[model samples]
Target: MRITQGFTFEAAHFLPHVPETHRCRRMHGHSYRVELTLEGPVDPVTGFVVDFFDLEAAFAPLLQRLDHHCLNEVEGLENPTAELIAIWIWDRVKPAMPMLAVVKVYETAMSFAEYSGG
Candidate 1:
């Protein structure tokens, strides 16, 4: 079984390569949603794959880094594609939670990308 936790952050981004008149070319925000999945044997003491509270704590710094900021201005995200963002977050939070199996980032209600085991 897998356990997943979700968090939300608001951030702005612009795709410079797009036409200047494109709506996404202007700095705009998305209510980004991140879902992290943990896979492995559950802890016998807590009877959970991973503690939800612990998951939230693990993601706190990440959330702070992205919340209310311009994602395009962040280092390493010059384009800020959903794929890049997923990988960026995975890199930062993976070490703290060894059980992580996948990271899914939702740019909108219908669009998202998954990064795993990298």
Candidate 2:
């Protein structure tokens, strides 16, 4: 089975690598939404692949670094694009959550990127 937890944060960033004329090159903010997915067999005793609260706690420190901060300034997130953000999240989370299957970052309601540690 698979379970997904969503987290939201407000952050500002710019794609420094983008062309000078591109709008993304200018700093902007987003009400970002990130979904962390985990896959595993349900624990017979706990009846969960992993406890939701435990997952939240495990991700709390990373979340604090992202929430209300400039993504470009965050270590390892110099680009801060949704695609890169997903990859960044996958790297940080997989250590604590071996079952983590995907890291999805939503740059906007209509756009998102998913990374499966690949």
Which candidate number maximizes lDDT?
2
Question: How do the residues 16-110 of candidate 1 rate in per-residue lDDT, one tens digit apiece?
Answer: 87888888888888999999998989778989988899999999998998999999888888888788999998998899998899999999999
Question: Which sections of candidate 1 miss by over 4 Å?
Answer: 19-22
> Candidate 2 at 41: error in angstroms?
0.2
Instruction: Give the runs in model 2 whose Cα sits over 4 Å from its true position.
Output: none
Listing every candidate in turn, what is its Cα RMSD in Å to the true structure after a full C-alpha superposition?
1.5, 0.6
Q: What's the CA error at residue 97 for candidate 2, in Å? A: 0.5
Q: Give model 1's TM-score versus the native structure.
A: 0.90
Residue 64, candidate 2: how far off, in angstroms? 0.4
On residues 2-116, what C-alpha lDDT tens digit does candidate 2 reach at each position? 9999999999999999899999999999999999999999999989999999899988998999999999999999999999999888888899999999889999999999999
Q: What TM-scores do the predictions have?
A: 0.90, 0.98
The global Cα lDDT (0 to 1) of model 2 is 0.94
Top TM-score hit: 2
